[model samples]
Target: MPIGLAPTVRSKFEHHKIDEAALDGAPMFDLPFNPGVQIRGYSAINQPNCQIIIEDFMPGTEFDWTFVHDEMQYCISGEMEVEVSLPPLYMETTKAHITPGTVFSYPVGARKHVKVIGDAPFRHLCFCPPSPDYPFPTLEQLKGS
Candidate 1:
């Protein structure tokens, strides 16, 4: 088969949707920059060039974050508004409401403020290019840079 003129072939790889049971017991990470927001997740793939993680964010909390590397997130459930500031001056911020099935990407050095809304947990699958021990930089660290 050809996809846009590129040769392709089907493989025997099996794919399955992440179920409710798989979301349980994710290890939580402490966010010193934003307290009271429950951030828990586990990494399914952490390799040299790629990293995949399933993260759950509890509702009714907002936090500021800056990625040290490039990342893309696919929302599986819940809702949130992410306001990403343009770098350099950061005089303006663009906001987007992310819902289930929405895929959002963040370039390295982009700063975003995430506000988890609604009553349920906001769950998303995150993909990154670099396998950093912790991908997000602290607010103070962002300032020091």
Candidate 2:
């Protein structure tokens, strides 16, 4: 299946091919706030109030992000070191080392710095649920942010 292809219809449900080869042709973009960092990904699921994305970050990529809505992420390959700020007052911070099979979540307004480490590209799946207002920012939209 080609990357960016609409979800396949499967008798009242949707299906998407998320293998790395399926996304090899997907376009890559630079994060506006992070120099020397590039990301390539495809949204496999786009529902009225939920979305699922498969993304790859080359080693050496680093950036800070703030969640627009609640999100969950599962690492599929490689590694990342993330520094997260505690909620409420957000006065304290913690670090997590993510590897394949790791699962983590971020609440709305959660902030973190992510660094792709190791020799290979870091791959992950990101899911946003319960609200459709928080589509991942596109390059154009991110440029002004």
Candidate 3:
């Protein structure tokens, strides 16, 4: 048989939908190292290529996250104080107050410390590629080719 490639086509019948209102009161779990900050996500929307997570941070709550994949977070409500830092040796850091309309991104394996900074709960949407490994990627995998 002749070697060949076929054009990719998305099936019209293949689709996904999430009703925001339906997500109200949905069971949200704590993220590691950052317990008390509640979060919910639709895994059907999280394919092999990407993930989407929605979070609700209590006032004065904070957490540290080290991304295993490239990620972008957009504040959807209230505001938050964020301290971003690169791993040791690289050592670049920044602090900012992010409110609604504020957005940011970080490369694979960047660390971030975030604190909700207002009376109201802070809400945000996070978008990122799925990690190469479950939970986290190996050091060698993080280095890339």
State which candidate has the highest lDDT: 2
Candidate 2 lDDT tens digits, 1-145: 8898998534235676665765555567876567767888766777756678888888988898877789999999999999998678888888999999999999888889998898888999888885353334433232343
lDDT (Cα, tens digit) per residue for candidate 1, span 3-104: 678754333333335535545544456766776666866655556666677778888878998878889999999999999986667777788999999999
lDDT of 3 by residue, 1-145 (tens): 3569676533233244434443444455577766567654333234455655555666777888887788887887878888888866448998898989988888887888888888976876667775232342222222342
Q: Better model by TM-score, 1 or 3?
A: 1
TM per candidate comes to 0.74, 0.77, 0.69
Misplaced by over 4 Å in model 2 are 1-12, 131-145
Clashes of each: 0, 0, 0
The best candidate by TM-score is 2
**Residue-level lDDT for 8 in candidate 2:** 53
Query: Cα-based RMSD of the predictions, in order?
Result: 10.2, 9.6, 9.2
Clash pairs, model 2 backbone: none
- Ranked candidates, highest TM-score first: 2, 1, 3
